[model samples]
Target chain A: MKHITDFTIVRREQLGQHYFALTLRHPGTLPSIAAGQFVEVEVMGTREVMLRRPISIHDVNPAENTLTLLIQVVGKGTRQLATLQEGDTLNLIYPLGHGFSVEGRNPLLVGGGAGIAPLLYLAKCYKAKGVETTILLGGRTKELIPVREAFEPYGKLLISTEDGSLGEKGMVTQHSLFSAAYDHICTCGPTPMMKAVGRYAVEKGVDCEVSLENMMACGIGACLCCVTDTDEGHKCVCKEGPVFDALKLKKWMGIE
Target chain B: MAKLETKIHNITLKNPVMTASGTFGYGEEFADFIDLTRLGGIIVKGTTGERRQGNAYPRMAETPSGMLNAVGLQNVGVENFCKQVYPRIKVIDTNILVNVSGSSIEEYCSVAEQINELPNIPGIELNISCPNVKKGGMGFGTNPEMAAQVVSEVRKVYGKTLIVKLTPNVTSIVDIAKAVEQAGADSVSLINTMLGMAIDVERQRPYLSTITGGLSGPCVKPVAVRMVWQVAHAVQIPVVGLGGISCANDALEFLMAGAKAIEVGTANFVDPTVTVKIVEGLQDYCQRHKIDDINDIIGII
Candidate 1:
C-alpha cells in the first residue's frame, strides 16, 4: 500500500479535441521517476468508473518535483480526471513498471497515439545523456498529435498522420527519415504500428525495442493477466517489461 | 500495537486477511508493494492438470464500481507449477492455498492428490466457480449432484483442509452449499464472481473476448454477504466469504452475516496492500467496540 502524500494539479492544457495534458505536483516521489514509467490515477469526479486509469509519464522535471501526464478522454475515467483543477488532490500510485533501458549511443524514438507520452520522456533522457536522438510521432490527423514544442529542444522531430494532415502525410514507415538512419529504434503505440516499426528495424539489421500496451489488472505481475509470449515462454509486461527488445517479442505479438 | 491473528479450521492465520484465489497470483508478484508475511494467506491462481492459455483479448472490462474477468483459467499445468512457481513461493511467510480447477472429477482428485504431498501448503480451495472453461469449472457447481461428486472425490485423496469455493451464478446458493457440506467438505467459501457481460455499443460487439465474464468488486458485496448468510445458516461447517470486499467495513459485514473468515478479491487490483489494511481495520473495529477477542463478532448479527 503506497500512501499518497499530496496531489496537486499543476495545470491542464488541451492537446487536441479529446486529449489533455495534466501537470501535477506529487512532491516526494514524483521527482525520482524514470522514462517509460507510469502512474495509476484515481478519478475523483465520477461515481460510474471503479478502477483507476493507468496513464504514462509524459514528462517529469526533477528540479521542480513535478510530473505531467498526457491523457486522452477515451472513457469515463479520463473524462472525470480531466475535470480536476489546480490544487485538486487525487489518489496516485507512481513510478510503476519497468522503464526503458538506454544502453545505446544514438536512439530512434517512435510513438503513436497515447504511446507518445513515454517517448517524450525517453527523448529527454537520451538528449541529456548527449546521445543523438530522433523522435517520430504518429496520429490519426495533425490536430491529434501532442507536445511538439517540448520535444523540439531534445532532438529531431518527425510527424506522421494517417489522413495526410501533417509531416509525411502518410504512415510513419513512409517517412523518408525512417529509412534506418539511426543506430537503434525504440517504439510505443498501437500493437500493429509498433510491430511494423519493429519488423522494419529487424530487416534493416538495427536493434529495436517496443513498449507494449497490454490491458493490466494489478499493474504488478500478480494477476498473470497482462502476459505477452516471448522467446522466454511468457513474461509479465509489468514486471519483465512494458518495454522489450523487439527481437525477443514472439511472432504472435507481431514482431518478426 | 499487537498484531492480530486468526484461525480457520486447523490453519492458523497471522491475520484474517487472505487474497482470494484467481486475483492474487502465487504471492510473489506483490512482494515489492506488500509484506507477504503480514498477510493471513495467499490463494494462488487456479491450476489444472494441463496448461490452459485461457480466453482471447478483451477478457476484462470495467463496470460501475467493479470489473468483469473471464480469464478462462489460464495456468501452467500442475507439473510446471510444482517445478517452477511452488519452489519460489514456498519460502514466503503466509499460508499458501492452491486453487484447484479441473474438467473432470478425476482431474480435480489428481490435482488435490499432488498438492497434498507438498510440505508447507496448508489447504486447497476447489474453484468450482470458473465460468469460462468448456468443461467442469462452473459446470459442476451449477448442478448440485455434480458439485457433490467432485467434492467427494477430491476429499478422498485430499487429507488436508478442503474449501469448496461456491459459485453464485446458480438458482439457489443454499442448495449447492448443502450439497458440498454433505460431501464432507471441511469448509466452504461463498460467492465466487457472478456471471456477467458488458457491451461496446459503438462497435456492436461484446466487451469481453468470451462474450461473458465473472463479475466481482464492491458492487457485488451485498449479494455475497446475503449468500454467505444463507449458506452459513444451511451448513454447520465454517463459511469463508468473498466477492467485492475492499475494506474492513466490507469484510466485517460478511463476518456479521455469518462468515468465519473473508477473502479479499478484486480489491487487490485497487490497492495491493488492501489485505494488510483490512486486517488492521478489523483489529481497530474490534478495539473500538471493546471486543477483546476478534472472533467474538463472527456471526453476531
Candidate 2:
C-alpha cells in the first residue's frame, strides 16, 4: 500500500572500492524525522533482487527536499541499488522506525562503517536543536568512510581506521577524545563495536543508546522474527526500537 | 462507514487481519498506526518460563524475495510478561493470544498455567516452530510424538483456546498437524518460517551470526500455501494459514487452498499499516464477488 512517488538519483559518488553515496530526492512533505531513523529503499533494478533494503537516513535537507544514503555494495541488493542512475525512479518507505532520543543535553555520537549514516543525521539534528554533539567515526580505512564532508558542519568529527589509513590509526573508543568528553553516548555499527562503546559509557556512569541491526522481515512488529532479549523481555528492533538505552541494552545484549 | 467483520475458529474477528506474534510486539507498539480494536486478534511474542537473550549478532539476512532471521526465542519469561506486558494489552479491545514457548513439556505447562490466570488473554499459541533454538522450539514440532506430547501437556493446564503453530521445516507437516490435533489442540496455525541460510562468500562466512536462519516473506508464499492445503485436507480442526500473505489476493489464495483463516506475517514489516489495508481489500473482494460471508470462501477448494 505504501508506494514511492519519486526516486531521483541525485548523485552517486564512489567512496571506496565498493561503497558509494547515492543522494536522492526526498518525496512528500518532509516529516520531522530524527537521527537514527531509517528508510526502506526498494531495489527492483534487477530481476535477482526483490525486497527493499533498509538504509539509515544519513542526512536530510528539508529546504532542498533531499535525502542522502551511504551504501556499501556488500551484496547483490546494494550492487543493484548502486547501478540506478539519475531521473530513475525507486520505491522507498521513508522515515520508518524510531530514531535516537535527544534526551541529554550533551551526547556522544559514536558510529562505525555503514552505521555512521544515522549518526551523521543525528549530529545535524542535535546541532540544529542547540544541543552539543560530538561524533566518533570508525572504519577499516579512510576510504571506507562515506559522507565525511557532510558531517563536518554538525560538530567535532573524529575518525579511526583499522589499517592506519587515516585519522587516528586505532579504534574510535581508543582515541583520546573518548575520555569522558560527553555526558551521554549513542552508537550504531557492528555488535562488538557497539558493545564496547556501551560498556565504556556504562563504566563512565553516562547513559548510552545503541541502534540495532537485527535481521528483519517485516520492519513492523508482526513477524515476531526480530525479537531481541532486553531487560523488559523480547523486543523487536523494527517495532519497540532499533534504538535502545545503553543501560537497558547492556542487561540483555551484554558486552559482546 | 461499512461493517468490517471476520471470523476465525469460534472467535469472531472485528476484521480478518490480525498481527502475527513477534511482529506486533505485544500489540501495544502498533497503537500509533492502526486501531488494535479493529483487528481480529493479536499473538504476543513467544513467552517461556525463563528469560532468553537469544542468538548472536547478524541475526537477520536478506534473500532474493524474502529474509531470514534466527532471533532465538528471546523473551522476558512468563512472570515478567504477566507483570508488565499483559496488564497493558489486556485493556485492548481485540482478542489477545499469548505465544507460549518452552524448552520442555514442564516449561510449556508452566507458562500455559500462568497464562491461564491472566485477565484478558483469550488463547495461547504454542510456538513449536522456532528454528533458532536448540532445545525446544522446532525440536518439538519436527517430531510428531514430541509435538503431540507438548500439546497434550499444555492442554491440561491451559483452559482457553490452544492453537499449536506448526513448523514448515519438517518433511511431513500433515503428520505433525495430526499429532497436535490428537493431543487436544483447539486449532492449528501453519506454516512457521522455513529453515534457510545465506552466505557472505567474500568473507567466507555465513550472513547471519547464527549461520542458518528461518526464512519468511513472499519467497515462502507458495510453499506455505501448499502446506496449508495439505494440512487442511489432513486435519479436522481449523487451520490458520500464514506466510508471505501481504494482500487480499494472497489471503484469498490460502482460503481457497483450505485455510480457515490467514495470518499476515512478514507483510507487517513491509508496511506497518498492511493489516488494515488487507482487511479493506478482503471486504472489497467479497463485495465484488457477491460473497455474503467471508467464511464461505474458506477451504473452498
Candidate 3:
C-alpha cells in the first residue's frame, strides 16, 4: 500500500556541487520500499512550483524508519528542495511504481549521472541475497559521480568520467566491465546510454531492466501524462513502471 | 451535519465534489491515497469508440500556476472498458461516470450507448469541449450548432443523465452552453482546459509534441468562474463547474457563481486527496455559515 505522510528531515548532506542526499524519517512505520521504486516529494511553501518532484529511493533503513532521496538540482522543484534543512517537515507519497526484480545470479548494474541514485539500494538487495554484483557508474566529470563510496561495500564499483578525472576515463558503456560475462543486467541513466546498454543486452541474450525518468505530473497513474510507448502500448511510467524490461520497450530495443 | 447533497437532473450526488475526467484515471489510481466511497462521483478518463494511442510522447508541460496537456483522449475504448475496466471499478461506492469523447458524432453516440447499459454507471459526461483531440472534441464545442448536434445525437442513445462539457476557447461560452442545454442535455459542465501552448526557450522548441494543448490549473480559475457565472444565468439547466478548482474556497466560488456542483481537475495532480478534502471543507463552510443546505448558496451571486 502507498502512503502520503509528513516526514521530518533527519539529515541533509551536500555530496557535490548540485547533488544532495536527504534522509527523511516517517513518524509512523515505513512501508516496504523496493530497490528501484521512487517518491513524489511535495515542495512545501514554494510559491512558483506546482508539481511534486519525483526522486529515486537512494537508500532505506527500516530500523531507523527513514528513507533517503538522492536529488539533483536541475529545475525549480529540485532547487527548492536543496534549501531544506534537517528537522524541517517534508511531505511525500512513497513506495511508488514497480521496482527492479531482484533475480539475477551475477548482475551487472549500470548508472549514469543522477541515475546512480537507485542502484545503491538495488546493490544492497543483491548483497543481502549473496549475489555477485558489478556496478559501473559514469558521469561527465568526477564531480558528477558523487556517491561512489556508498556502493563500495555492496558490490565491485567501477567509475568512468568523460574528462578523465576519475577511474577509466570514458562513458560507462566504454568501461572494461561491459565485456565481462554477467547473468543479468540493470541500468538507469540518460536515455541514449540506457538504449545502448539495452542493445548490448539483447546482443548478449541477457535480461535487463532500465528505469526511465520520464516527465511526470501526478506521481500516481491518474494523469496519464508520463506514458512511455511500449510493445504492449503506452504504459504510465509512474504506475506500471519507471523500471521496465529492456525487451518490452520499443525504443530501447530499436523496435518500430 | 450540514446537508451536502446536491442534484443534477435526476442524479443525486452524495456531495458536490466529483473528480474531473482524465485527471482521475479509472478511480482506482487514487484508491491508495483516498477513500473511493467518499467522493460525489468519479469521472474516468476519456473513453472513445476505439482504443486511441493518443499523441506522441512529451504530451505535458508545466507552466507558472498551471500546466498544459495534449493526452489526446487516450483510453481503452468502450469495448475494453466494459470488459476490463467496468468490473474492476464497479465496486467503488460513489457515483461512477465516464467522460465519453469521440472523433465523430457516430463514435460519440456509440460509446455513450454502451456506457448507458452499465447498471452501476449513473451518468455520462459528454465531452464536446476537449481541446486536445484534433477531430471531434473542441471542434464540436467551439461552434454552438456542432455542440448542440453532438449532444442531441448522444441523448438519443443514452438514457441516463447527460452532462455536456463546454470549452472556454470560444468567443462566448454561454452560447455553447445554451445550445447544449437546448439540445436535450440534462446539465452543462464548464469549462474544459483552455487552448494554450508553451515553448522551451533553452531547447528552442515547443514544449508539447502537439505544440498546442489544454491549459488548466489555478491560473484558469478566474476565467472559469467568469464563464460559469455567465452560462449559469443564460441557461435553465444546472451548471457543473470545473477548471482549476483546488480547494473548498475555490469550490464555493463556483457554487456562488451558480454551479450546482463542481469537479476538481488539475488540483488532483498536486494533491491526490484534494477532492475529499474539498468535501470536508464544504461541510465545514456550511456549519460555520449556519447554512442548512449547501444548495441554498447556489447562484447567490
Candidate 4:
C-alpha cells in the first residue's frame, strides 16, 4: 500500500553538518512499509527546487506512527530538506516501489554513504524475522558514514572507510568479510560498489538484490524517467523497483 | 456550486482538470492517492505503433522550478495498450483519452484507429509535439504542413474527439494551432514542454541522456498561458492548456487566457492528488467569485 499525506516532523536530529535524520509522525496510522521501500518527499521552502526528492526508508516505527528519512545534502532538494525543523510539515508519497524480498537463510546487507539509509530498515526487518544478518557499510571517510550505531542491534555491523579512519579500510567490496558465507547479498550505495557486489554474488552463485539510486521525476511508473535496463526490458526504478535482482540487471552483470 | 462541466467537441469533461499525457500513467497508478472519477479526464501515456525503449538513463534533470524529461514516449505500444491496458483502465467512469504518438503518419493513424475501437475511450490526444523522440514526434508538430497532414490522416480514422497536442518550440504557435484546426482537429492543447537543457556544473556534463529535453513545471506556465491565449484567439477549436500547471491559480490563468479545459502535468509528480485539489480549487474559485459557470472565465484575458 502507498500513501500521499503530510507527516509532521516530530524529531530532527542532525547526524552531521551534511547529514540529518528526520523522524516524521503521520497524523494517521503509518502504512505498512516494507524494507527498501522509499518516500518521495516534497522539498518545501526552496525557491528553485520543484521535484520531490526520493528518500529511502531509514526506519519506520508503526507503533508510534513514525518514519525516519536519513538524508544527505547532495543537491538543492536535500539541502532544503536539511533545513526542515521539528514541527515542520513535510508532505510525502511513501512506501513506494518494490522492496527487497526476504529470501535465503543468511543475508549480507552492504551500504555506502546515504545509500545505507534503506539497509538499516532492511536489517531491522530481517532481524525481526529471526534471519541472520550482516551489515557492511563503506564510505570515503569515517564522517561520510553517519548513524553507524543504529544498525548495531539488528546485525553484525562492519565498516570500511577508504582513509582507514574506521573499520578495516578500502572499498566495501574489498572488505575481508567477502570471504565469509552468506546465502544472499543485498547492497545499496554508489553504482560501482553495487556492481562490484553484484558481480561477486553472481560468481559465488549467490542470490543478490541491489537497490539503485536512479534520477526520478514522478517517483511512480508514470514518468518512466527512472528506468533501469534489464534483461526483461526497461524497468521503472520508482515502480517495479528501486531494488532489483542482480541477475536481471544487465549492467550489473556486465552483460550490457 | 459552480458549473465545472465543459464540452470539447462531442466529448464532455466533468470538469476542466485532466491529467497530462505521460504524467498520469493509465490512471490506475494514482487510484491509491486520488479518486479517478473526480478528474475531468484521464489522458494515459503516449501510445505508439510499437513499444518504445525510451531514452537511456538520466533522462530527467531538475531545473529551477521545473524539470526536463526525454522519455521518448516509452509505452507498451497500441496493440498491448488495447490488449493489456485498455481492459484495465476502461472501468474508470471519467472521460479517458489516449495520447497517440508516432514517428510517422501511418503509425499515428494506426494507433489512433486502434484506440478508436475502444468503446470507453472518449478521445485521442494526437501527440505531434513530443520533443524526445528522434523521428516523427515533434517533427510533425514543428512544421505546419506535417502537423496538419498527421492530424488530417488521424482524423480520417479516429471517429471521436481529436485533440492535437502542440509543442511550444515553434516560432508561431498560433500558426501550428490553426493548421491543425483547419486539418479537422476538434481541439488543441499547448504548450507541450518547451525544449530546454541543463548541465551538471560538478560533472561538466549535460544532465539528461538527451542533451535537450522537454522543459516543464511552473517555469513554463506563463509561456503556456500565452500560447493558449494566442491559439484560443486564432483557432475556432477549443484550446486545452497545459505546462507547469501546479495549482488552481495556474489552472485559472489558463482558463482566463482562453483554454476551455486544462491539464495538470509535471505537478502530478510532486503531489499525486494535485489534479483533484485543482478541481476543488476551481470550484472554490467559482464560488468565491459568484460565477455560475467556469466557462464564463474562458478567454477573459
Highest TM-score: give the candidate number.
3
Q: What DockQ does each listed candidate score?
A: 0.51, 0.37, 0.83, 0.90
DockQ of 2: 0.37
What is candidate 3's lDDT per residue for A1-256, written digit by digit as tens? 8888999999999988979999999998998999999999888677788988889999999999998999998999998999999999999988899999988898999999999999999999999899868999999999998899889998899999999999998888888778648889999999889988988887778999989999999988989899998888889999999999988985645855
Docking class of 1: medium
True contacts kept of 3: 0.78
Enumerate the chain B TM-scores of all models.
Answer: 0.98, 0.96, 0.99, 0.99
lDDT of 2 by residue, A108-158 (tens): 888888888888878878887898678889988887776577777888888
List fnat, each candidate.
0.54, 0.46, 0.78, 0.97
TM-score of 1: 0.94
Task: Give the 10-residue window scoring lowest on summed lDDT in candidate 4 chain A.
Answer: A247-256
Q: Write the per-residue lDDT of candidate 2 for residues B1-301, one digit (tens) a residue.
A: 2344655556766765676777677776666667777778888889999887788656877787788888787778899999988778899998898889988889999999999998688788899989989898899999999999899989889888899999999889999999999999988998889999999888899988789999988899999999999999998988888998988899889888987677887677666677878888888988898887777777888
Which regions of candidate 4 deviate over 4 angstroms?
none
Report the Cα RMSD per candidate: 2.3, 4.2, 0.9, 1.2
Output the number of the lDDT-best candidate.
3
The local distance difference test score of model 4 is 0.91
Q: How displaced is residue B284 in candidate 2, in Å?
A: 2.8
Summarize candidate 4's per-residue lDDT along A179-254 as a digit string, tens digits.
4389899989998898888988887888999999998888888899999988888999999999999999856468
